[model samples]
Target chain A: MSKRSDPRLIERVLRGEHAAASRALSLVIDEAPEADALSKAFFPKSGSAQKIGVCGPPGAGKSSLTSRLVAHYRKQKLKIGILAVDPSSPISGGAFLGDRLRIQEHAMDPGVFIRSLANRGMIGGVSYTIFGAMHVLEAWGCDKIIVETVGTGQDEVEIGKVADTIVYVTTPSMGDEIQAMKAGVMEIGDIFVVNKSDLHGSDKALSDLRSAMSLGRTHEAKPWEPPVLGTSALTGKGVDELGKALDDHWTHLKKSEEGRRRLREQHKEELSLYISRRVYRSALDKISDRNLDDLVEHKIDPASLGTKILKK
Target chain B: MESKPFRVLIAKPGLDGHDRGAKVIVRALRDAGFEVIYTGIRQTPEMIAQTALQEDVDAVGLSLLSGAHMTLFPQITKLLKDRGLKDVLVFGGGIIPDEDVAKLKKKGIDQVFGPGTPLTTIVDYLNSRLPSVKKK
Candidate 1:
């Protein structure tokens, strides 16, 4: 650590200093003592970035879709941030975090930043650590941030609450579209993309999504129907359309009061969740060993005991 | 005597999702007696920093296979400097080219471990760079 606290680093990062940004992210992820104070200092300048979450079942090519979307976004001269969450190994409580190698093509781009989060047995599917990461990206001036979930479970649905736009990706052959629909994936998507569209039954998959959308009574909103686009991410087909759809959504959002309201609501939800997690962690940390023994001996139900202790 | 274990945060930056190398490094770091926080693939500079801050770690090690190291590393370094965390050593390993490694080091990256670099190299580097603490 340097003897002097250098605010220049933050300024440099804001000025697009990639090195500075990398360093700052390291500090944040590592949770060094000073990192919190630094982030607090930079908090006022954060939240300018747009957050987008992409989620779907495992093996649905979520990572591939994210890589392609990032490439498309970069072409538009926008700075992008990516977060790929992977499940932790249950036995070891470790994670491979291997998604980074799949998109090595963008390894050198200054306009793109990506991070992989280990689930760490976080029951909600998304890792507890990811929320902090999202805030850091916003502070770094990324125009858009994409968060990819580990699995397409209910936990993945939580992402819809964090992102400004939620894109649900499904491949044609994996029967994921059906599973997604059954899992209520259709309800959360702002945009549905059928990647690997060159495969057999691509049209059928598209029709399935279309029929799924039609099965619902209303189109959700005027001029805001969730559009399904076929994409062969391998060949870069339909990527442009996907990008345009994202732009269109952003434009629509800007034009509508509901969009702003939704954003505000999302922000409130995020803040509440953040605070709740902190409070829960703090309260749990305060639990005494004697209390644990009592609970283990069935002297008290954990929930009621916790409520009683919290009341104090 | 009980001693604090060195805590290290291993993060992946950029859209590259191939984390085989990062995962290997995380295990190596843990086996070497450090408490490792492995942030899985596709991390941005901002996310990495935030996790690092919250975890209160001693070192931040990034694993970037994507060529975005140039853009990602500098931002992380700057953020640390900006937030007054000059002591937390920031290093990484991946498909980074030798020339870029030099550039990153010059930009305050403590070290850059490229492909084919041994896990022992990383373990040794951490052991050397971090302050000595008693292992539990």
Candidate 2:
């Protein structure tokens, strides 16, 4: 009932309490401080789960692809967690949060956990609260985690940096073949998948992808070649093969030091940026003179001043 | 004095654009006296972590309806741990099943509210879980 009494609920959650975990998640979502403590209590035990990032352009059938992958993974009896990030309404700066409607198959599957996040105006494709949720899910013993980004622009490329394996979904109709050739989205893909393959020109799209892959070829002893797979996510065709390919990639990662090194780098970069932001925000909050005193006085340019402050 | 309400970021990570439940929860959280930051949608784990750290939010809530929870949630958790923002609460609500709730709990998810879960329950949970309020 009171914030002070929230610890018991959290305690219950930490001790494998189910109902309390649900309650605590809601509290955290509501931004309650008690939820903060609960998160702290749980943080130490988190981060063992493997995270996979999924991204692509809008209308790429990302939801359908993700849902099929869920079914595929479920067949392996692995505990799965999905984080679907949706686009926010530009006018209200709020998200419709519509991914739930698309993937209704997992609604009753106790082995699956699906959470949606709104972009909330972050420049890159992700939600502010996603990391916390990921950590919580990992600590809960999920073997695999999949993060889906809002499909749009080059921002989704950010998923490549966070996910162990980035699955870039495309459709034959969306001109993804041409889009892939344009550079930004081209290089970030670890695996290229063409969904809605039942449509005409699907083979052409696959060939285009292959040609694109060949064009970017370099001599760096590649561990695994990014493969192009075709699938009709609606009909479940080629879903099994796609799943197998993903599994193969996971296996390759387990055997190589390159994967571990990249993960460490990701962690390092993430931490540094996080700290810088924190320090900058603290300075902003403590500054009492909100008006542009320095800018108006012409003492320093806004861009230069921003860099100077952030450097500290 | 009117205190600066708790800043809460409610985000949808990944490319699943079904966010009706997230919107509903966001409204409920806002009504409960929190300054809610609703990130429009489609976010990477890195973006979400970065936003939380930058915003200095008291809590970060994720809504996932796509089945990418296993991959997405763990990355966010690890990012927070690595960033030393282990104190920020991270929880989620969506189409998660009952069995998965137990698994997520083990992953440090303080809570997991599924479909049909009441808003009042979320409100009460927040009231009970939040730490002592500080006037900004």
Best by lDDT: 1
- Highest DockQ: give the candidate number: 1
Over A73-152, each residue of candidate 1 has an lDDT whose tens digit, in order, gives 88789988887777666664545554654554565576777665666566544666465667677777789988887766
Best by TM-score: 1
Clashes of each: 74, 84
lDDT of 2 at B16: 91
Q: What value does the lDDT take at residue A292 in candidate 1? A: 90
Candidate 2 runs further than 4 Å off: A1-5, A8-47, A89-91, A176-178, A218-221, A287-312, B1-136
Q: Cα deviation in Å at residue B78, candidate 2? A: 36
Could you give candidate 2's per-residue lDDT for residues A134-236 as a string of tens digits?
Answer: 6656655567888888886754466766678878888787664566678676687778899999999899899988887887778885888889999998899
**Segments of candidate 1 deviating more than 4 angstroms:** A1-9, A30-47, A176-180, A219-221, A297-304, B1-136
Reference-based lDDT, each prediction: 0.73, 0.70
Question: What is the docking quality class of candidate 1?
Answer: incorrect
